[model samples]
Target: MSTIEKAMEQLNRSPGNAESVKPKLQTDELSTKVKIATAYSEKIEDKEVSVSHKKQKTLFIDDARLKSLGMISLNASMSERLVRDEFRVIKQKLLKNAFGVNRQETLANNLVMVSSANPNEGKTFISINLALSIASEQDKTVLLIDADVLSPSIDECLDLGEQAGLIDYLSGEIDDVGDIIYPTSVPDLRIMPAGRAHHMSYELLSSDRMLALMQELANRYSDRIIVLDCPPLLGVVETVTLSNLIGQAVIVVEQNKTKISDVKQAVALLNSDMNIGFIVNKAVHKAGYGYGYGYGYGYGYGSKGKNK
Candidate 1:
């Protein structure tokens, strides 16, 4: 058996305990560490569990969640074209955006909205990729939920066919949320697909089941930073329902692409007291600072957005 296989078998034997899953990082094999994970960043901490390399609080994903045969959701594959030497720089910037907040108290308040004034605004790419970036960073756990029930992009991102996601839990069809959660190839990162498609996505999100599921996740995975990939606030009522679910929501706008009227309307709908942020995706800038390829971090309300 290969080393990875052996590790898997050990992991399966004692799945609940945090110690079983962490395999030692062989510093002898590689001088520079490729990744650094911690239980603190992800919000899971287990003291008894001690392992070499970066220590991460383990998760109890459904058996099928991590399975290979039917695994629908897959992470973006690393390409040879990427400059390996500078990859860490990109990851660092993403860490700042996903987790960075106004104050220590606001860190947990940094929620994101995966929306645009219209469809095809590159919201899904930003949502999923940002989630992945945070997960790949050491010790942080990111829960990517497909709140875009009207039209889900995670299905394509993970390439998983038909069924299993939030809709199931919301509609009273799925008994266990664990059954629907899929562990991506990336560590410290997991995804909950859009579940089965439903015509009334807005109704589903407002149901008792939906609220229960969110509460359960928040209570159990207190350390995790949950990112809900919601629908476009302009037309979808699902985004409004999600507003109550998350403390903060963000809208993704394509610069010079989305109509100003649409953005204004969406902002009004999401108005009043809730934490809202925007990511100016697909916008051209004169280059403020070369922080690699990903977008830089900006927390809370800013002049760059319509809020001011």
Candidate 2:
């Protein structure tokens, strides 16, 4: 078998306790490293159960609720077409990275994370919109995961109450990952809530079980794209830990509000080998275009080495 196929087989057969291939990071030391990088002024679910037989939970999102939040919804009107087109461009780039001829097959290119340098930069907004956009694709399936365990808002954004999800599975509270994956009103879109908070969230995210689960998600379906709504890159060590598993990242930068230094610092912590993209949230275009979000995709700031 080819190396990629063998690796996929190994991932499929690997038990939950399988050792994580990614190097472990010392929280305190990593935190210190992040701090210094900033000071330098720009330096820097184990489940055997099958999903087919299980009766999955359904997540119902109100169109009005989405409209109130200024998010994209199904059956978008002419007025919402602009935002949809914007995300169409964003998702096309991601899909190309995940499955295009130039794509990296070994890495988990199908798994993508939507995050930001700091909180309230509209990462969640982009995450949901991106997932919605991809779901509209005729041949693609999307899973929207709320990985911001520290402060989960996806549930609220989708008008959902507290639900068992990533935290529950990682903490061994939930055995079958399928149980936590909720089918949304949008046919091609599914969601996994952030579950309850825990003091050991950082450890849980970096555990072997988490790694195994990621492998499973990445290889489960050839056309599936997993989009994670993660915490801000700074302060939260869990976000950094989660970055090690995914193949791509989209960092949201709030046009006038986000600081360039913070963005640089946050980018410094990401897996350099991964394809990192940027989204300028709440941007104001001149004249007819009015105010809207902007997006751009590219490699890391510099150097070709993966973040270690």
- Give me the candidate number with maximum TM-score: 2
lDDT of 2 by residue, 137-249 (tens): 99999999998888787887777998899998889888878888999888899999999888887678767667677777887889999999998989988778777777777
Clashing pairs in model 2, backbone N/Cα/C closer than 3 A: 272-307
Which candidate has the top score in lDDT?
Answer: 2
- In candidate 1, what are the lDDT values of residues 164-270, reduced to their tens digit? 87887777677666766766556777777887777777788766556556545544554576778877777677566555445455556554476656766776765
Give the whole-model CA lDDT for all candidates, comma-separated: 0.50, 0.68
Backbone clashes (count) for model 1: 15
What candidate 2 gets wrong by more than 4 Å, as runs, is 1-52, 283-308
Please give the TM-score that candidate 1 achieves against the real structure.
0.60
Clashes of each: 15, 1
